[model samples]
Target: MYKFLLFLTASALPGVAAAQSADSDPAEAALAEIVERQDAARQPVELPDGRATQPVTLDAATITVTATGLGTTIQSTGQAVVVIDRKEIEQVQGADITRVLQRTPGLSLSRNGGAGSFTGVNLRGANAEQLLVLVDGVRVADPASPSGGFDFGNLLTGTVGKLDLLRGSNSTIWGSDAIGGVLDIATCGGSGVQGSFEYGARDTRFAQAAGGLETGALALGLTGSWFATDGFSAAANGTEPDGFEQFALGGSVFADVTDQLEVFAHANWSEGTLDIDGFAAPSFTLGDTAETQDTRRLWGDVGFAYYGNDLTLRAAYSMADTERDNFDPAAGSAPTFASDGHSERVQLRGEYRVLGGLSVAFGGEREWTAYSTSFNAREETGISGAYVQLGWVMGRLAAHIGSRIDDHDIFGTKTSFGADVSYGLGSDWRVRASVGEGFKAPTLFQLLSDFGNPRLRPEESTSFDIGIEQGQRGRGTHLALTAFRRDSADLIAFVSCFGATGGLCTDRPFGTYANTASARAQGIEAEAGIAVAEGFRLSAVYSLIDAEDRISGNELARRPRHSATLFADYEAAFGLRLGADLRLVSDSFDNAANSIRLDNYAVFDLRAAMPVSDVFEVFGRVENLFAENYQTAAGYASPGRGAFIGVRAAM
Candidate 1:
């Protein structure tokens, strides 16, 4: 049967490709009793799960998902994906998405040193660049910039309303960068008045204010935030200091021209400075020290959506202008790098509830990325693609199948396919499984980089996942467990000690980027949330990864062995919320050679807030409570235990 589906989806030829459920469970006991009765009869009874036949609710679904490129709620989709809302973002006091991901299970990172400059994100076994980053559904990659890839430094936990982390292969829906997975950022439109202030140890501080005010057809919102830190010391004598500071501002607006047509836009800008450090701090001399290099990014996107009785037409235009300059006075001739990117995509997808429990939809996208670098020649990419997906439903059975064909101008053409199936075992419980093929084309920087190589080939992957989800009726408590495995081919890796002229790294000069042998990654993720009691709740997230090479006998660069995160909070009757958390990362290597080792460490944090009055509230947090020295970057140490305090005022 699975083979039939594969052949069918694959044959859809040059053809193609292709959440969260928002359902309530009632009297799980009744469902279990039925199961028991069937088991006693020594037969596979038809069972009784009324939910298997209910219609999906539109508003109560999960919008961002991995299995299908389309936006839909969790309960309605057939995949293993999760959404991290703003409330949960605070429940963890997480400064970066990486910190939040460690607790997410099945996902991990390879931190450069700190969130200072070059950082990357890895999903499954794919390289950091393979995991795509999107803001308001617009692509944010330079293709021409080195880390034009996804850099966690841009992580603004405070500026986002929610985060959608989709596991497995997403090439079918998102195009190239979707190989390993996709990280979708959804910004809040600021409705009504809102704000928050948090301060902690090591001179760390953060403040944000946002609100949405609507006066008829026009809805507008403004949000801005500031972040800074004194940092920690990795090696006692390391010359560079362990600290940093940043300032950011942004806003969004939306208007409804009619009951069926709406337009929206968002923008953000940030700048900061940080101390430099050497590999073996305290014992080694600082290399290429920079007091701070200032950077600013401006992202703007405008889109129009028309929702009809059965069809939707959506179009968006986006532009990203990222500029960076080194403030260090000594690094002579160090060219300032800048990236300008633009994308325009129009999607025509329509869905209809077929006669029975079956629904079908099809759509296509033409995406163009024009990237220019201040230090090198420009590179361009044009990808035209179309896909169709079908969702079949019946009592106790449902399946989703999808396929996509992308035509790339320079990287060669490619195709992707995927399918997912799920059946509710009974109240509060469901089992799911999925299989798919994914890919990542060469980035502009990888192909036309200063040390760029033109012979680079696209990276590819095969993946599978099995998961279980459970939630209590109406209480908002939920638990999920998912196990995943991925195999990557023609994996891309940075080789050191290349060509003659100087380069980013001596070995990387003439080395140029090339598809390495292969890699394998397997892991499990688990999460839980429960209202400990009314007004108080706790959430826990954890992930484990075992990633490695196919023949080199080396572990992939930057992928960690284990990670765990814990969050707890208490909400007071006065509308105040207090929270605490613990974060941990296991040991791992920084390079492919696996010589440089990063030690394992766990850090704790505490935060509290009080609704002082009707228009004011005060909050603060102490990070790294134990002062346990750790390095997000290989040689540099992160900030030690520190405290920050602040206030929020709104009308």
Candidate 2:
């Protein structure tokens, strides 16, 4: 790895020397090149229903072919879905990954302090561990036991190009812990010179810069962001911690291995510090602060694809070494490491078209993960799985069905399967139905977790969803309403010991991550977007959620009852745009006992943009404009009202 890093550094030396030849690079050569390419490859396909559609929204429903396996799109199927573009992300700069996750429907995000703190999500009301997250299609999740949790804080906002939210049970195509759904973050690819820099504040002080450049077939991109503040008080009132951060850098090389094939090689790396400035214990305040952690990620992926008349053959391998070191409190004290995990995945898949409107995709993959820690524990796990999917469309009826079976070294074998049927109801209406089983394999953190029991089994789930979609195209509207119900067994939960015996158990085995009685989650998702007129758009989403354990009858922790968002944007002549939105969440409970009640809150945001010329545009936004103080995070406080203004210089 060191050698590889050195080679990359050496290769980049020329660009550095060239930039240094100039005075501060004021010409902004990079941004001009990036715009040239983004307009070239991967054209957004027209939405089947003629609404706002892009390659991401339409293709996420199928995992057909890619580095991970077969890549698919949601718009290609009837599954509930949503896709957010890089433009949106860039416009909302300074917002953490968790905040970006919240803007999407059927998903909820919570975080601690600022950067690198414990930022997590309650995806569709499923356990945090039950929701799976992927970066460029490879899983980026906590190796800790199941229910151990994934960190939203680790993702650098600038490195992300787009986010695809495949709503509903996705275990059938994605495998374990996909009990809820998948959040796929595809990094910016096929780069040319592109970069942006800005200074802003929204309850905090911050600065950010990101850019990408390409030479020949190799493209390199990097982004860095920093923030500081005396944060707001907790929900109940206490000094919110001061969180500081530093994360940046990513690069990729794309070369056509042959006229009919190509290969992609990429790497992502970052380092940061998180100071838990808040006090959990007043008496121990002197030594109370949580250690500042140093973090890092090194990953690589390579693949070859052959495009034939009616078939595509693809194969790829991906590997990543992820580490986080916890430095203890006090000056010059050594840190006790929490975990250092490594993962590797290899996949082979082929897609063939048997006839018009009919295609079949099949593939197999193997993944290995190992965890090493200074906490007196370690675990190794492997997953071998194969999947087959068929899609058939004739006239107004389209049908899709898929089945996958994953064999684990432990926990025996598990299978997930689902079928979807959609029929075009005349007069601008279509109806669809789907049913499937999902599962979340216990993570090493859950099974061999430091304080965990080894006898635990994988959690199992089954879900059913039915929906109606209707709308017009281009100048029309798109709408979908879906209702879902899921039943799960061997549900995992923290088994509390209470008082003195409780706090001592830091591992999952001690008082948490136990296989509990069964559980269930039922909910409704409604989404709609329309272009009423040229350059004018309106959109809204609503979700009513109910999540709980059947046996314990305890309301699952951190699950909110209802969440909804409404947004409107208007585009006028002469390159002018304006938008506003409102987000609402119902009251929620924090623990199993339901002793903590968080009041419901609604937030409003406004934005406006105008072109100074064809190549540059000045934009501004006001978040939490009303200054309503609220907490989406548990004990961690949230910032109040804030504002920012900037300019985008595009070619």
Candidate 3:
């Protein structure tokens, strides 16, 4: 039936020639028909497993909002960007978002243990703290964390419907904490109800429900998910098993008050409880302990938009709150440690087309952040920023230039500039280049905690990239290659005050944060996709990176020099789908000292699905098919081979 569906899809193309025409090549014509349909509908055809048979492409019709703070086609933006839609998310079939993200180029992951553990995603070998994350347009970074970074541990994929990853520095448009890149995530939306449930290895259970309503003047959506697992030991040599549980809920609403005006609001909340292993007494070594960490996060935003013939305006207010608590059975019944953080932001932005091929985009924003720990008093700071961008598009060439200025309550003022150009050689080829500047202010915790440094300077960085692409991804044969480099200075690092009696350590005996480090990262990324046959496809992504510290000349921790992913999928005529993927990583150090090494490893996964009816489908997958034993971090044992089965329903 797969071929019959393809035939029906091809026949629906409005202006395309028939696939079976004697004057046309059947394979080429069929692929062209698929691409046309994808572009016209803005949605790809789904396979039995709810995955798109063909990957989404960055054609003129495909627009990305993350690249320029406004909708822009990838063909017009020089920045490296990747997009994943809901269909692709279901293809991975797991709660862990990292699994689906790993397939993207120039990206890698490091987790402390199994699912729900502290996980970090590194882009182009940049520090995890340098990347900015947004959920439904709300910044969710933890202000109380040492580096003010978002932890991916509790970020499940159940409610996420789309993701846009813009790689490289983009401070001119996004302001601070965008030194590495930006990740924009949108929640599920539509006019129907859908749900899924699965039970897997390690006694794991996962469930999700989402529903939406759409009318001529209004739209509403709500989503909820739950996850629980009896996980394996976090410590490699430990005996006892660790467990984790999480709950999440989100809602959104949009109303058209007039023909040219709209109002919208979004809210999300999540809570997680994770059993963790810590240094045990007596030996003071890494071991299993009766310890657990609880985290709760809440974020929301409300906004309005106005549209005109040649102008658009938007205004928004957003807020985020985070609370964390740690407990140890041996310590006491109450929590042993706790922290709270909060952020509020207000912004106004607008864009206008000055000419048929020229436009101007501008925005201004103000943010206030506060944090408090059990041992410290509440502290707060504020920052305000403004930016402007000029975009020009003439025929096959497109370019953008932008600048920004930010005033920090404690750090004074700073300026950033960026530029990019993209030129299309033909319908099947394109070349692009870009350069950007980035800066990040010190976090509240880094400046006000017991180990804080009141005189710390902001971290700064410069990034550049050049690339060439042939053909669109998942259309016939496609290939892309890119070279990138980034240099960072005044990087924050912890400084030990042991036995010191002078300088900044005169009154401090433990440790303090300071801007005393520099680093450089360079890498090359390559990606290829082939439509090998009518119902089969293959894709691969690879990256070579060299990340080093300028002061110590040592390789940065937990960054592998080489990494690659290979994936293949096939759809049979019997309404059955099969897929497999393999991931490979080279050896890397687990510490800044470069003494401990994590061994090189490879992991494989297999999955299959079949539709039982028009509304329900069954699926299963086996992860770590070979049961490979490896670690992404020292002392942390990764999950072994596991199997899971599930059913999905849609209306």
Q: Which candidate gets the maximum lDDT versus the true structure? A: 3
lDDT, candidates in the order shown: 0.63, 0.63, 0.82
- Identify the superior model by TM-score, candidate 1 or candidate 3: 3
Question: How well is each residue in 129-213 modelled by candidate 2, as lDDT tens digits?
Answer: 7777777666777564245456777776666766767666767677777777777776654332333333356344444444455
Residue 519 local lDDT, model 3: 92
lDDT of 2 at 615: 50
Clashes of 1: 48
lDDT at 221, model 3: 80
Tens-place lDDT digits, model 3, residues 1-651 = 322332232222222111111112111122233333323433343434454423334322144567887556667688888777676677778898987888888888899888889999999888898999999778999998889998999899878877778889999999999998999887776656677777899998787777667677787888778888999999998988899988888898878799768788999999899999999889988889999999999999999877655677778999999999999999998899999999999998877777755779899999999998888899999999999999876556679999999999988898989999987675468899999999999998788788888888889999999999887555578788999999999999999999877876876789888999999999999989898888898999999999999999999999999999998888888778899989999999999999999999999999987777776678899999999999999999999999999877766
- Residue-level lDDT of model 1, residues 1-651, one tens digit each, is 322332232222220000001211111111222222222333122446322243332321244444454444455455667676555565555366665665555566654345454557777656777788877666776544663476676666766665777778767677677767887776654345555555565556565555557677776766556666666543344544456556666676667788767777777766666554533345456453444555566676777765544444556667666665544445455543445544555555444444454656566777666566666666776778777778765555668888888887777778888888877776757787888778887766777766666677778888889888886212378788888998889877676554455644454555677676798888887888888887877777777788898878798766777877777788888677888888877888877789988788888988887766665656677778898976655655565666777565544
User: Judged by TM-score, which candidate is best?
Assistant: 3
Pick the winner on TM-score between candidates 2 and 3: 3
User: Model 2 off-target regions past 4 Å?
Assistant: 1-73, 145-148, 202-236, 278-290, 426-428, 471-475, 496-513
- Clash pairs, candidate 3, are 1-573
At residue 450, give the lDDT of candidate 3.
Answer: 81
Instruction: List candidate 1 segments past 4 Å from native.
Output: 1-61, 65-67, 113-116, 230-239, 242-245, 273-288, 331-356, 372-375, 393-396, 472-477, 495-509, 572-576
Minimum summed lDDT over a 10-residue window in model 3 is located at 16-25
